[model samples]
Target chain A: MALDQSFVGRTYPPTDSYEVGREKIREFAEAIGDTNPAYTDAEAAKALGYSDVIAPPTFVFAITFKAAGQVIEDPQLGLDYSRVVHGDQKFAYTRPVRSGDRLSVTSTIEAIKSMAGNDIIDIRGEVHDEAGEHVVTAFTKLVARADREA
Target chain B: MTAKIAYDEVEVGTELPAQTFPVSRATLVRYAGASGDFNPIHWNEKFAKEVGLPDVIAHGMFTMAEAIRVVTDWTGDPGAVAEYGVRFTKPVVVPNDETGALIEVSAKVAAKLDDDDRTVRVDLTAMSAGQKVLGMSRAVVRLA
Candidate 1:
């Protein structure tokens, strides 16, 4: 089934603030085998002018992708999660994410297209700090492949 | 955070030292736990095959993380990255073996995006099993 073109430009409400944790940042850095001192040592981060340990560039994906679940799970959209594959990802940051900061994301459907029997959905997640300062914007493209048996 | 590299010192086509990262099943498992992405296709071989994948695959986000290290490592500050993006063109198939897979990443200064901001765009190419896994991968970093 084709997605509702009207769903394009639909904006979801802002998500509750998710506090960034130093340990979580360390864990993520370790998982990727990144040993950059700023990711683990608060002093090193401070030396670099950050108030706290700063997360790696891709760390916000965890937060923003989760917020995008609202659009992916919308029944009216009829997206089959099992068939979906991440196609592309982009992020523009106003500043690096620092530990102890509380962030929230508001997701909006940027575009919806159908091509070669596949459904493509583009979601833009705007992240903000507790003070409503724009922190980053994440653009995600999800492709739902055509069902073989259908 | 300020970048270690000076904008005046870098030119278009300047190359960053290439690096390779190994990805085993354990690596994927650890990434899944840390990133909160418990997709079965990243771990369960059978489920991945059932889903039309060759075998267990690495997460696209994980690959993206690995690729950007080239830029961050060069800048000497993780916070210097202003923008980053990638297209998952191919999956990095990880075989269940002692040597699971290797992602080789190399980047170069592609263009000078801004002068006042001292930012340059770096284009990265990531390969695994001799096939490009990411396309249109790039990062815009602010330099001192």
Candidate 2:
């Protein structure tokens, strides 16, 4: 199915706040084979100038992907979730992600297009701290590769 | 807690040695288990082709994780990485074969950020089948 161009510029509301936890950070670090002390020890993070244990750079993916679900599960967008492919992801950070920080993401539909028998949709996620400070802007491109005649 | 490579010992254009990581079906499954993301497209080839994908593909995050490992492993401490990001440019197609699959990755000192803090930023790349699967890759690390 073709994407609804009318939904091109829609902006979704911010998702419920997600609290970062040290155990979660440690789990993520272990899963990625990263034995960084700052990710597991609050004292180590303090030594490095953070209020608490900091998350790995890619930890934001969990937050952004969850927030993006609002846009993906929207029937108004006419997207076939089964046909989607993850094209690209980019993040611009104003600050690092820390374990104790509560974060929320506001997802916006950045672009919608059709190319080479594929439908492309770009969703940009703006991650902010509990105090509403911008932390990172994560961009994700989802491509629907279904063979459809235009 | 810090990188072995000193800021003064390396030039801005020095390339970190490239690495090739073999991605077997088992590895992808292990990644799915670790990440709590069990999307069928990464493990089920039939499901992938039915959804218009060429075949079962490696998770984008998996590739990014590998690329970051190249940097963090060099620094000897994941905490040394203050910042990092990547653009997923292509899908890594993983076929269910004996050789499984493979992705080749490499890094370079893209930029030198000399602050009083003793750190430098490293940029890296991960590729499969000659397609640039990752881009705009940047990492900030504290040096010894």
Candidate 3:
């Protein structure tokens, strides 16, 4: 089934704020084998002018991806979770995510298209800090493969 | 994070140091826990095979994160990256073994944008098992 084209440009409500914790940042950095001191050491981050420990650039993906769940779970979207694969991802940041900051995301359907029998959807997640300041925007492209036999 | 390189010193086509990132099943498990992405395909070999994958695979996000280390290490500041993007063209398959997989990343300055912030666009190539796993990988970094 094809996705509803009307969903394009539809924006979901902002999700509940998620607190960016220092420990979680450390764990994420370690998982990726990044030993950058700014990721784990507050003094290092402060020296760079950040108030506290800042997460690696990719850390926001975890939060923003979770926020995209609302779009994926929408019944009207008719997206087959089993057939979907991530196609592309991009992020633009106003600043690095710092530990102790609270963030939320508002997802909007950016585009919808069908090509070569595959359903391609683009969702943009706008992340904002507790102060209502823009933090980052993550663009996620999902491709649902068409059934070959069909 | 203090930037190690000055913008004026870097020119278009300057290559950052390359890096190799190793991924094992245990690494995938740890990443799954850390990222809160509990997808069975990234952890359970049986489930992954059942889903028609060759074996358990590393998360695309994980691979993306690993590839960006080359840029962050060069900049000396993870936050120096103002924008980053990638296309998951191939999966970085992680086998259930002591040595899972190795992702090799090499990046170079592709372009310098006209801006007062001293931003440069970096083009990255990530490979695993001698095959490209990521395509159109690029990052825009603000240099001091």
Tens digits of lDDT, candidate 2, A1-150: 568888878899999999988888887777665667777888877776778888777788888998999999997787877667777776666766888788999999999998876899999999999999998888888888865544
lDDT of each residue in A1-150, candidate 3, tens digit only: 677788999999999999999999999999998999999999999999899999988899999999999998888887888888999999999999999999999999999999988999999999999999999999999999997877
lDDT by residue for model 3 (B19-125), tens: 99999999999999999989999999899999899999999999999999999999998888999999999999999888999999999999998569889999999
**DockQ preference between candidates 1 and 2, better one:** 1
TM-score of chain A of each: 0.98, 0.94, 0.98
Q: Chain B alone, TM-score of each model? A: 0.98, 0.94, 0.97
Q: Which has the higher lDDT value, candidate number 2 or candidate number 3?
A: 3
Better of 2 and 3 by TM-score: 3
Cα deviation at A40, candidate 3, in Å, is: 1.0
Report the CAPRI category for model 1: high
User: Against the true structure, whose DockQ is highest?
Assistant: 1
Question: If scored against the real structure, what TM-score would every candidate get?
Answer: 0.99, 0.80, 0.98
Error of 2 at A25 (Å): 1.8
Cα error, candidate 1, residue A99 (Å): 0.4
Expressed as tens digits, the lDDT of each residue in B58-102 for candidate 1 is 999999999999998899898899999999999999999999999
Candidate 2: which stretches are off by over 4 Å? B1-10, B17-26, B49-55, B75-102, B111-123, B128-132, B135-144
Candidate 1 regions off by >4 Å?
Answer: none
